[model samples]
Target: MTRALIADANLIKKVQAGEDPIGCVLCNQACLVEDVSNPIISCQLNPDAGYELEPTPKGFFQTRLKPTRLIKNSIVSIVGSGPAGMELAVSLAEAGFEVELFEKDRELGGALRRISNAGVGGVWCRSLTHYLARIENGRIKTFTDNEVLPDDIAQMAERGPLFLATGSVGSSCHSTMSGYHNWISSSDLLKSPLPAHQERVYVLDNKGDHESAWAVETAACFSDEVVLVTADPSPFSRLHKTGDLMPAISRARSLGVKFLTFTEMRAKGDSVEISKRFSPQRELVQDHMVIEVGARESSRLIEVDGNQTRQIFEIGDCFAPRTIQDAIREARCYSRALLELVAT
Candidate 1:
């Protein structure tokens, strides 16, 4: 059955290149959000996701027509080599600008790397691999294992433009949980080592996104029993798309993980106490707890913006916490606008 599904030439090619052609374990935000606003079965990663026509749609085939470069030989220092920073750096480089991207981590890709390592990112890892390959051959100079401080930004701004895309940090758990000793952040669990041999795991789903779903799945892997408590009515509530949501739900069910919707959870010693929201109910207990709340913009570099240069700008999660596609699109638009400004 799996062999039959891998019969497509394109899928074969992708697999041969060590890429995931089918699994897209994204949050399905673009698909659902687009459906609400308009009615397109679009994908955040692929521009031509669901469009199938004779000659294909005009927008599907349309490519970015490179404008005449006016910003020549300008050196742009970009902080944080995440999706937003990489997209902006590549755009600026293509526009005949020298780009130097610095990442605090040893490698690029930011959160995607950690998410991929958690084995839940699906095709997101392929996107990161592609981006890394592009950066390797592109004119953009990358500096891994380098943290860009505010002073560094000021110094860079003295030469030319300085862009920040420092991504986001995990949001602190604000739940009225009594115990903090055994609690772990979602990002920390994804990046660091997982807890071994948990008897009972409780995942607090604050985001109601794929991350929460993935957290449940991850916990289920190491724990004998798992419980996901969320204020939302359903797991992956934001993921209304058929392609993304069903598989995620199926995966969770297969792992024997229980879902407690419209519930609030608090820590109580060795056990996590969960209660039904707006109901007279009994509080259930679990041995371990993981908080899968969303993150806030991490931008200490932008806090002390002593740079007087008009070119100093912040993009990506540093500007606001959003999806990877949102960050890339914003960076691309801003890069084009900057080019237009220089041209004018």
Candidate 2:
């Protein structure tokens, strides 16, 4: 409730005042657990959120980003335009680095772009990209729809430092049970909204996070019988870890979305099969299926080796798939490192 009020009511007041609200993302990551030990509790978007206090040991979260030593317009190549890459680009540019941003997609905002379509709280996810893009505008040179291949990394590194945040690829059980042709990712479904005529929709809650919940919510829009299948005993069980379990379940049930937990899906010849534990397996319908099983790091570009002349830093999901908070904070830390390195 407090987080919601700050993000909503307080944010509104700030906007009305014509102030840069900074838009509290309401992630509740920092303050939620800062008192336990070394305090890193601070806003992910705000670089100086905890500047008044002493710095922590630079864990998953980072704060107090200061690039006091300015560079002489040295070029820094940032690969992938996800939240992490965008944040790093803006951070480096602010520190006087000539930023060269690249994205394979047509636009910026890697996973957040697709995340925006998932369900509630999506608006902020999308806006975050816009916020970073706005800050980097005219400051960074962006190359969208341009993939930085493995071969291209060494070339870019030859010129300057490379920050690779190649993001990740979503996967589900459907990946192993291919050839059915109806299986699709929740993100892909959001990008290409499902047809209105769908009779039923099934979502594999492999993620058990907001994305999985978001998929079920999005699926409910087009199909009356939206079913969420999960291996966990309680569907969307992970939401409780972030203070959203009950709400997600309530919203999902209100939307007529059903749950099938402790269940597994299998490939039976040309068709897919599904059944709960200790239950008889039944052939599944050939309807559209949305999988929210999380993703693996996209590390194809990381295979190439770096040399003494140039340094290649893999940030965010490329380092290992994590939250947007981890992404932005890591970028902030790197930006500070970049300044210290090149300034000397």
Candidate 3:
């Protein structure tokens, strides 16, 4: 409806003149947010969201996102072969459309692969294999180690439907702080080799996600004095009733990983300045400082102007730095919409 209003000036005028829009802005209150026990998906705002399929009272629920064989010639260009991009590409390709997938990294699976390799085994890691299998099939034409530039977007836009799923990046304290001989982000630790360090390992848990805890776990295994400093009262607090946080926390504790909650930490040369909530600052000399705060959307799509294109859409982390579920949901919905365009 937002896109329709933008394209059709008369519709925008009608909406301004007290007319109702045709779409929901996906506020993710009832549909997205849910308890671990009852995974029944029902949208409070949009009744049509989960009404297409039979409602399951318990267990994991799947969507009715089957492929629609539309135009065989219409090529869909997808940037980033992550969950969102890969999901979208697979859907479109299965729908009898040619899909060209571009990934900046040499391999596929974006952040999903990174987390999976980080030894954070669970549903997330399992899901990576599923997505990888789907995209690795002969249906999608994938380009690895190819970062899509502005000129590339412009060229692809002229060809056919273009979607941007260029994921996100981990937050670093290097922007604010100085020194700390060895400084690494959560993603850095997850992907690259562990930096050379002695005893002290100070992990700055910023966002308090599962990734932070897993990174802390990895750090704890190597370093003797592993201290997790976080602003949140509890790490991985966002993972409501997932039954993942508590066990991981317990394991980290067993591994001698100390927790310092409600604290702010910054790197200062050879030492790190740590301050508790409403407390005076104290510097702790550490050999390694790993910062795991949060992630920001990749600016690849933002920098590239796709206005001149026929149909351009951005889904996943490129759209907003949300969960894997949110990215997959958005991709599925948008792909359905684009399929309609091909049908017309």
What does candidate 1's lDDT look like per residue over 142-222, in tens digits?
889987766676678666667778776654544555355667767666545677788887777767666776787778778
Residues 1-344 of candidate 3: C-alpha lDDT, one tens digit per residue: 53333223356666778954333333233354365686655432223354446432211111211122423465779998877887788778877788999988889988777666654446566666666766676489999999888767767865666788886654443343445566666655654566665487777776666677777777866777888887888866665445567766777888888888888877677766778887786756565655554533354554534246435667787776776666776677666666654464
1-344 per-residue lDDT for model 2 (tens digits): 45544333456677788854555565554435434675554555654455434343343111221232323444788888877888888877866678899988887777777666455554446456555645555478988989877777767765666778887654443354455566666545544545565678778776787778778887777776888888889988866656778888988989988899988775555666888776776656554554545534345465534243235677887787676667777787777655555545
Query: Global lDDT of each model?
Result: 0.66, 0.66, 0.64
Q: What's the CA error at residue 102 for candidate 3, in Å?
A: 2.6
Q: Predicted candidate 1: what Cα RMSD to the true structure? A: 7.9
TM-score of 1: 0.73
List the candidates ranked by lDDT, beginning with the highest: 2, 1, 3
Summed backbone clashes in each candidate are 0, 0, 1
Residue clash pairs of candidate 1: none
lDDT of 3 at 225: 80
How well does candidate 2 match the true structure in TM-score terms? 0.71
How many steric clashes does model 2 contain? 0
Candidate 2: residue 204 Cα off by (Å) = 1.1
